[model samples]
Target chain A: MPVDHKRINGPENTIPYKLYTKLNVKSFKEALQDAVKNGVRNDKRKLDEHRRIFMKTDIVSQAKGSAYIEIGNTKVVVSVFDPREIPNKNEYSLNGELYCEFKFAPFSCPKRRLHQQDAEEKQNSIVMKQALEPAVCRHEFPNFQVDVYALVLENDGSALSAAITCAGLALAQAGIPMFDIITSVTIGIQGDLKLLDPMLHEETLCYTSINKNSKTGKNSHGIVILSLLNTHQQVTEFYQVGSLDIDDIEECTKVLTEANKVVVPLVEKCLAKHVIKGVKESSQ
Target chain B: MTLSEAEKTFILHGVQENFRIDGRNRDDYRPMELETSIITHAFGSARLRLANTDVVVTVKVEIDVPFPDRPLEGKMEFFIDCSANATPDFEGRGGENLATEISNTLTAAYSSNSVFDYTKLCILKGRKCWKIYVDILILECGGNLYDAISIAVKAALWNTSIPLVKSVTIDGNNVDMNVSENLSDCIKLDISAAPLMVTLCKIGDHCVVDPTSAEEQCSQGAIVVAISKGKFSTVFQTGGGSLHPLTLMEKLKLGAKVGNRLEEALSEALSKIKENGEMGFLN
Candidate 1:
């Protein structure tokens, strides 16, 4: 059944996307308007340039590992549950581990979505699992699978980015040893500008620009999904530009390369504080 | 609550001694946390967490042709989704029954003219009208779901800013709407008469408001009373257990009293939202 966007009874949380409305297929007009409104400003920064960020772990006492990360208005809480045995073997992957869910709760949208899981949610879980695989040395914790749940409690834009950033923090909070801390950043291009951390409005109007024949726009309009290895301060896995081809891959590496530079120290700072807190708590 | 002997003894002793299960008196309400304007893209929305129960409500307004029979009346629909966040039992398609029941109750409660004036929502008789959609999401079920949902819905309605529709044109059967550009020129729904739900759980001979999950499991039955303007908008008696007419009447009285208090509290909360206000989940 087609989920009616307006009918879903969730929360009345308004996410500002109306700032990017297109009159027609000439989405360039809207993109240009947005570029003028948000892109041209001196505040418009590029990929690899990171915002001041912070994260904390063990905020939710009950959760196995819970952490909160903030990237401007994008605040997310990620929690990791101890690896549990699979309920149904039929659905299991090659590895014994299974079960991952990501959700922007009903109230997370301006127009509430039905709380039931949908294709978008399923796709997000896959992305989350893929980003997490490289960071989590799953071989040691075999026969069991950890549930990495990311809740976008507040989304300014770049939720996928926040999810990657927050997931590693949660794993660390849960005391799960990992090779590195993972951070993701989304970069969108509109004409002569590249916007770092495209807000909810920017992402919505992005597709319309692709509908137009702006090849250069397509190059910059690409998305870079990166997972950071905290110790190495490196990009372990990268997923980018599903719709665009090799030639159309406008801007590459800058977002992930930049994200690694900006995000590594922030993650380390949080981890150090968490370690100190754990020692203090155990002593108490 | 149809408590076992030991449980009954414990509760009675606690109530008499001024300490109930969650360590509070009979009249004590659960802690409430409310977050507003969180949904950045919605017309208006709010989340209310009363204890462990979480309710998220959003309001969306769309223009549509008014019903032929009710030419001057607009449309307002209430839909509730019993989400899995409440419990594992609500996973997948399992929560439909509870969701439908809650939505039906909300529909009935808001059916009265005094509760929500549909006529005011009309643009042109039989030509154009504003249909307000109120969507409710139940996240966690600590207890007192009805009360939390109702309060959140009311607050969301108050926060709703209906776009100021400019000069609606009707040509034969076709209707053309012109929307105003002024953001400040918006109509706010007057929800002073909006109904508040009071869930009265029958625990032995007494009835309790806002019963916990264990208390609910122990109860024989529960009655949902929707009160607006000090009048009964709807009374829904749910669960399998039956009660005598006299007992039902007594429960109705308790519901009425509780309903009044709820209405008062809701109005006070909504008014405070208009003034300098502060609330969130961190507390």
Candidate 2:
């Protein structure tokens, strides 16, 4: 007798499994238009508007410095440790090192994540390291390495951008000398519509190509995450998923850079509060 | 963290005189704060802070096949991850050894049927059962890790809400379970018989219940005793020191006495916890 795998092993499927079934049942073009129409997105935000941000510093007492950030439903916490001598490197170098580790708690996302860091998490860590290396004064502490760990407590959308923003704030709070602070934003492109700080549902729809006309086979859909050094007006790191036209890419980049600027002031205000508190404690 | 000879003498004399550095008696514990149902996505969750040590536990439930030998029983697993935020030494894979040690100790303590009833988790005797995954994340380590972890695990288990099985239809090796659709239709686990572990650190000729990091370094040996109800469920020795039989027996007696009191205090705290209270790292 042949065993029925669908009946026995199918109970463990997650929400994504149900989502795929629903997608196949409906017309793709109709859903796309419903998500974006009449100068507003599904969440009732304007085309270029970003989500509300809440940020704080010195949340984790164990770490040397820490920050917690929340944008809409996404929550991220970053902790920075004191600088230490680079391990397993017998020879000395002039430039200091920055080690980044990005992790999502097992219960952070809709689907359960494994305890070990997956490949996507490793890639995000490298992106974070590259984004902050130029802004940080690595030559200040020769032969030493600073460790930064970012953990996502809840991942609704744009989690990597939140991590980058929080990690930079944590490093500054640790008193590491930096040329300037870095900020990041995510942009979602679908057809002629551009969504800023898209939610989880909008993000998934943006990634899936829904060609209004199947005969043309032409679809412009992608997600771009960009980190910017606002003080210097330079792009530090850029990552994109899926395919988009050259013209659409340029349009998305311009919108994301402007969005990044809106977040810088929030970060500055949080850091200023932390500094004032420290000065007050030392004087007393 | 090396201590000089004079510093060691100070700690030894302090323990002998019963005047600890923090002014606590031998069987006293530090102040602890506990919050449950913190993680929104998990079936059950809890966060515990014992002075400087912080631990978060989340429980996830899934349907799984019962073991061939034990058809009526369910399964429970413990996974521990030590975050680098606690200390630089736990970076990367460096904390694997400590994580393994803590998880193994928990597995041993929960292995007995009397300590935690596994049959309550069963949906269908020989076909399907509920597998509980208890994931523990250690954010900080001050000392007395075993005692802190055991208490947090018990509290998290108490907070767990397993979905009620409305019906189970079996058709020739195919089992289909219909769980209750209402969110409030769930069963809370009965954790009264769950074991509580107490770490007794022998300093000089006396033993202490909660030892700070400095005192842990000065102690000669330590014994972790897990008590379920009035009996010992599991007892094990740790650290690099030898213990005389007489002193070992004395420490075991002290551990049992402290374990019972700790269980009573924990259950009291759990009962006082209000539903929908403010919970998380923010406060």
Which candidate has the highest lDDT of all? 2
| Per-residue alpha-carbon lDDT of candidate 2 for residues A1-284, written as tens digits (9 for 90 to 100) | 12344543333333444434665455557877777789887778898998899999999999998999999999999999999999866568678988888899978976677666665676577667767776688889999999999999999889999999999999999889987888889887776778899877778777655663365755566677777778777566655554454456556667877888899999999999998999999999
For candidate 1, give the docking quality class from DockQ. Answer: incorrect
Q: After superposition, how far is residue B11 of candidate 2 from its true place, in Å?
A: 1.4
Q: In order of the candidates, what TM-score does chain B achieve?
A: 0.90, 0.96
Candidate 2 lDDT over B208-274, as tens digits, reads 8988877898886677777767545555555433343335556766877888899989999999999
Candidate 2: give the clashing pairs.
none
lDDT of each residue in B90-122, candidate 1, tens digit only:
888777757765776676567545467788899
lDDT of each: 0.67, 0.80
